[model samples]
Target chain A: MLSRVLYVDIGKRSSWVVDKHDIFSKYLGGSGVASKLLLEEARPGIDPFSPEAPIIFSPGYLVGVFPCMVKAVAMFKSPLTKNLGESHAGGHFSSALRFAGYGALVVRGASEYPVAVKIKDDKVRVEMADSLWGLSPLDVERSLRESHYEGMQSVISCGKAGERLVCYSNVIVDRYHHFGRLGLGAVFGSKRLKAISILGTGEIPLESPLAVKEMYEKLNHEVVLSGKMSKYHDLGTSANMLELNELGALPTHNFKDSRFKGAEGISGEVMAESLLRRKISCPGCPIACIHLAGLRTDFAPEHEKGKKEVFSEEVLLPYNYEPMYALGSNLLLSEAKNLLRLIYHCEFLGLDAMMVGNILAWTTEAFEEGRITLDDTLIKPEWGSVEAYLQIINNIVDMKSPFYAKLAQGLLETSKRYGGREYAMIAGNNGMAGYITGYGSIVGALVGARHSHLSNSGYSIDQKTMNQPLSHEQISDFLIEQEDWLYALYSLGACYFCRGVYTKEAVCEALKTVGTEKTKEELMKMGKEIFHNLYKFKVREGFELAEQEPPKRVYQVQTPHGMLKAEEVKAIIKLYIKKREGEGLRLKPEEKALKELLR
Target chain B: MKKALRFHIDVLHPERCIGCYSCVYACSRHLFNTIDPSRVAVFVRLNGTIANPFSVIACRFCKSPECAFACPTKALQPLPEGGITLIASRCEGCKTFDCISACAIEALALDRRTKLPIICDRCGDCAKYCPHNIFRYEEMK
Candidate 1:
């Protein structure tokens, strides 16, 4: 019944909580609510790094209560696209913020000095963090742990890449989880906000405790007892290695080939058999899908311990298919340890692993093509060269070199500068997500709101397309409908992993427990409304529909089906723009208006 | 002399612990019908780093319970089988917070919002809900 929005003005070092009931109740939560806030608070022409531009973190409506509903969104105008920046992460962030008595947290205004904000229950403290400044998320965690950030606390911090204003820098949470795209970290750095620590002790009020318990048990049964959730439970999403490899849709060496020869080396089964040490989960998640891997390295023994004694030391890090694919197959780095080190470097520096992988892929191709030389990249980025990638990873965060400064802007901009725009393989200034699976994915990337694969769920459509091919109209219909459903689920704060659990019937039933009774039709309506609202925000922020173009590299690449035809890719993207513009009665007026303004 | 039976949360294989905090949620919901993991019977503190480390804070239910002895109001009564049975109604809030400081592992923490000490009820809900069997249920004679 109670939802509070905590607004912090860093320049003034002041904060306040406002009960924005109408906004929250309508939008529900997560990115939907945050998008509305961005519309209200963000000035249209202000720079993303300016004092007036705000960074908003909103927990989902069912965040503290619902099972598998874990992600919290950090929203802002993107420096990368200069349009919309919305990134999400899973950990204890949502639950912590909700239990701390706030539904949303907005950080506005740039601070004069480094600062870390602490939120414990109702009290918010803005403290100087000079000692903790300029450190990686991992190093900052050490300082935070020694202070009051122990025992049931979640921290969101930026690292060196962010401090250097890398366009694709991430806001890292709990080291492994991140709001991992589109320059939110730069916004944090520009504000001089180092980190946020939350300690929540209050219990969330449940409408019907018994009903909620019943739904949870059912969801748990679906998650644990069924084979549907087992892949995630066992090897995690990296199981896609063999499947995607067999699909011939594995993007290898900068989209040159859709298949990698060394696919088995970094496959989920091998990772589980060798490096997997633990399976961690976010709050209320029964699946425990996040696999923590152990990276073993030999180090010099102490003189007292003995000379010539080498011991293997294990450093544990968590990974999913996206990171593994981006850092492993795409870069042609087969060794597990090398992939782990590269990924850890990205994690430590607070760079989006997906974006980093894309840029690295492009950089390697550029080097091979002789467009950029060793002097520009500081290394000969040969295929399968982990050593070169390691050196370049350091340069990415440092951003001191001329080439590295261009790299910070992201693959699209950098490729344009270095003569590889055709092979850049990006959508809306964002990198591809380790999947060149099919036309659905490629088209979805181009046509998605804010150019995110997850936005339209084209990955699922890609799978569906493999079994049964669809017409351009059918694909467009699928994308629009899935987008609607996903928007609703995200608003409800339900994780997509539990898509099996939160079916239309299941979600409606679950809502009954939370004192909200709605037919599935009404839910779909809300989703459609959210879809329009997001487009409105993006359009007003100067996102031209024509700019969402399919790169030439996508057509050149091979997919599971065969060679993807240029006409097919172009037709799908064209139909997408058409349906979105001229169809759908509810949004036709706005779409017409947008068409007039843009055309 | 009769051999005594005891139960312990065998976290000897702490590496196996997924850091899920499922036990925490299970305990809190089963006990108070709430979702705050902090109010739960067990709390898992993840190092929150890319490099691994984590600690699950829970009462050991020791052979000799110091928290029980530290309570001036006799609010905490030691069970013969091990662990303490807390009588929440009988408790007058401890000024010294001796029960909290008495525990070697600091399993018992004070909820400053309510100014009340929180102690584990030795409810095995955590053991039941843990997906990985990280919390081994042990009965030793």
Candidate 2:
């Protein structure tokens, strides 16, 4: 059951499960497994929007059997960033897929009209979703959830944002969490697939059920008692606002400055006190990182009292450090409620808030510089003005004008068209995450297989150099090692939030239950092999590492450490390639450039 | 002085349940030697959005025990303290499941595989593994 990959061809409206024993066994799972599948199916130079390019969903190997290992990764050729595409969602996505008796779900081909794929255990059906196509993710979810599959069901859906093919559009898992970045939703839109509904009633067999149960109990108990996740469980990830602000690492006003003066206004402490309604946990996760923030409308006392339901709304928004920094502080919107309202719009529309934030930041700066006008955007961009931003967002989603259409394509492409390329702030064509800490963040993205900040925990590495004495070359070495190790865990279905708990030994222990036995050393080797495979796919897809250059804004912004250093980042990227070369890391034509640098 | 006590499963806080299904797995692992929540007695029902609180359902083990009395074959028996006990051999699954109706809370239902009533013996497995501690066990009341 755990060794099969489900393939769905929307053109034919047919689905089948194939045994991919070696794929899951060798790569483990998640993006690691997806990369190998993509290599086989997705031809180089194929249009990313073409039906031939597969949209893959691979749940981690440890998913459905372990706690906090809930992330299900989406792998595709990104429509937003234009290279290796990957996004992750938390909720019951992985569990649902596992329960539906598949290790991965590979979706290919385009439908003539909108449709939703339903997997009820062994049965698979593709139903027309013409009515559901243009609906909001929230509305679409409600409709499909009522459509009744067997047993417990979960829907992976995209909203109007995806239907409209917004490049940074997201695939929302359930209502709150998302495969939030790199435009996987846009790929779904291209395929004319609205959603994938799964009803799983299958059980994963454990080699030693009793020992597995004991292990699960031990990890479960430690989750609550240990202070390791106290921050996440208590105030949610938004608590990082004040902490990053104090460190002068929080992105403010499109990274003109790293710290926001009104940081306290939107801090996690304030949100938890003023607007937090509840803390929601992802499936199988004890540490509930998602915060449900309440938005109350101002009305007459009598009206407010009589119409409580209409006046008050609770939106399940993960007020994590990334979104808070990107949508809140980065754009200089200081109030928590305003940020909540804006995030609710993004989440409801299925837009990637971080990418959207970067786009807004670049747009605002361009407008301020007089490069864009009211005629261009239909509004005068202003800092911290939620009203103005709201109008722009509508325009972007509607894409009525050429300006708004370009904006929908993400910051990089929009900047090229609008004459703000210098301030675009994108790396590897993908929008940057919230933090602008230092060289670590910039370099991590440039070298990242997916060009994600967490790809190697670059900002974390930057903070490391502050305390520990490590040279630039050593820093690059460390980052490379971490990326390799993290990819191993990511493939194994371990969440970055709980990676500390699912140590190599712990993963081996968990794997042994499901009939895979490997020592810690063997696991480490597997990690590096998977890391190389992802790079191989990227290189094949025309991602040239040596041709990569930092977005001009990376140098202009004042980081926590000080002004950014282009040469230092360049040196680090060079050192990184050298380290990879030492390990026989192969690239395509990009290998020539990197080799020349080595000489 | 220490004394052995009969355990009773109670949903102490239904509103706070996050529907992680940890309790279901725990209960199943103990009773069936497998990790199948459908086999577990306790149920966590999720509807609407995740914004809404999860509802955990289980037999409250009523004081009167109507399920015990409604049984035509005397298949349902009253426990010494609370809750109803099911005698597997004497039970009949066909021609209208009367005990499932007798349980007012809709907590007692036929297991999908076995087609027998999923009666909570109140073994305390569900409460022990509830991630949020939504369930509790105490002396038979």
Candidate 3:
């Protein structure tokens, strides 16, 4: 009975709930339902920042009911990629939304002034939030938490970057987690929306309690007692640092070198031994993968009567593989403390760490190449200079000058203007993730829906091929197969980290317990169809495969599998295109209605 | 005859809590056959920092429970296991909810639909499912 879809019009300051039984029953939920809604709600070729563009939040069917099913999917037209903007985050959001008795929430239209949307179960209120207009993401969360449900509700807010409409800005979820990729925060800013707070105390009845308990215990036992997930709980994905570095697959210094010599300095082992504080989890997840680092920051001395002159405060910041790679080796920053400070600034400003690292790296290289001088950049950009990077982050958020304004648009566009398209290290106008592994990685990223590493994990495929070689055809087939199945798992709201546990069989069994029955073959087919549907939206929004070529920098590097040429990557992507659609891309909208498609 | 050994769930290591809320969900699933926070007897909340980040609220199982004494409808009664038990039929769904205020630990919650007090029955489900060993089920002295 997960059929409720809540629509809130920010411009009209009104809300309504609609029964989307056909959507839920046919498409399942999460990204599947989100895709359908996006096509229906957003007008074709409309500007992403337009008030009419919709921000759809859909928590999959399994969310709030199963262990590790903690993610909620955010679907919007990305201001960054200017195509389909999709991101998933884990926190209290999915559970809160589920218990609020809705399968999905769509926010449409823009407001004239800054406001916050607060939903306590069915009661939705759009209130003026002028006081929270210029706050950082962390400060906004703190302010909303204190004023709302006494820190019990889930809150998502944008930083100054988002408010300023930085194309690469992100939305922080419940302080630690985020709708990190694309530019959902920019969308929030475009609507003049400040924050969203949700609290739910409603009940969802279990159809067969004993059956659910049996299935739950089985999965929970596999998750906790198996010791397979110990790596995730122990050091989190930060553990990948040493492994990827050893394999020489780690992207360092703008993909100049495949391995970082200072990898050990910022590896998870060192972080855990020296700076690790406490680990927390999203609701219902036993794996506490969110690792916090405690850094003692000193303030300038303040002289006062009977008071201490200098003060120090401990700041707890979350760290993960992507940011560690992006801010650490990618910038030649070796020290954990220095990297943490830069990451803290980026998180505080609400910028995507991967894009920020890519942009700064490109800027440094561009500075050295004399493509842009001190006139364009007020301060000289250098490698491993934390102060310079911090100032640059602030400048980008503040939109300090015309050059910075272009840089804030993302490195792809900035490089286009500043004359360094070759080494921009971007695919599809989105910055490259920290994986310069090989052909599968670059080709998969170039053609993947969001141009994200997580979209297909092509880097992982490349790593596996180090021992067993995968031909260009094999790699293409593997990426398409993996991407398609992943769409199905995502629609189920499984956290990316927990994908190993929620295998196709486990997914089938879990759904059965909830009175949802889908055969294994049907699930796989659903995955393929969902991926096609996503690509359909992307292509409709002017995404052309011919334009998304792997950057020249990727060709210059020596990966673990040795040198990768552009031809091999192009061949792989071309093969992927052929296999994904047979001959040409499907541009024509289906003559049949969506309900008929379900039939 | 010797009285049966009484057991109660206790917070043994609050420092180890990852704030997963497995216990809260487990309590709800075991008692109500649903995923309902309003019907659960345990609650966990984020405190917004690395140092002492999460606060866990669960029944302390008082011997002479003030909640039972404050119950005007006689819905709450002291159990031998050192916690209060709710007789849902006897609950009048009153407006005041004096029992909720009487509990000093703030462990008591009312069902949004039924308005009956949600009290721990000493089932130890919360302790059994806790991944970090934050809760413990032990015999009361």
DockQ of candidates 1 onward, in order?
0.44, 0.47, 0.54
lDDT winner? 3
Per-residue alpha-carbon lDDT of candidate 1 for residues A63-128, written as tens digits (9 for 90 to 100): 756667888888898988887888878887888887787788999888889999988887888999
**lDDT (10s digit) by residue, model 3, range A1-599:** 68899999999999999999998887778888888888888787879899999999988778767889888899999988889999998888888888888899999989999999999889999999999998887887777674313223688988888999999999999888999989999999999998998887676689998888889898898888888688899999999888989888888999998899999999999999999998999888899999999877866545433344346678788999999998899999999999999989988888898889888899899999999888888898999999999998898988888999998888777877888998898888888888877888898888788888988888888887786668978898888878878888888888878878888899999999999899988988887887877888987787877557977988888887788887777777777777776724463344433445789
Candidate 3 TM-score, true structure as reference:
0.95
The digit string of per-residue lDDT tens for model 2 on A77-109 reads 898867788887788788888777789999999
Best by DockQ: 3
Tell me model 3's lDDT, rounded to 2 decimals: 0.84
Worst 10 residues of 3 chain A by lDDT: A144-153
Docking quality level of the chain pair in candidate 2: acceptable
Query: B1-141, model 1: which lDDT tens digit per residue?
Result: 122125566555556666666777777777678777666557676554524556776777776789989989888888777777778777765688788788877687776556567756555678877777767676655
Two-way DockQ contest, 1 vs 2, winner: 2
Interface RMSD, prediction 2? 2.5
Categorize the docking of model 3. Answer: medium
Q: Each candidate's fnat, in order?
A: 0.53, 0.35, 0.63
lDDT of each: 0.78, 0.79, 0.84
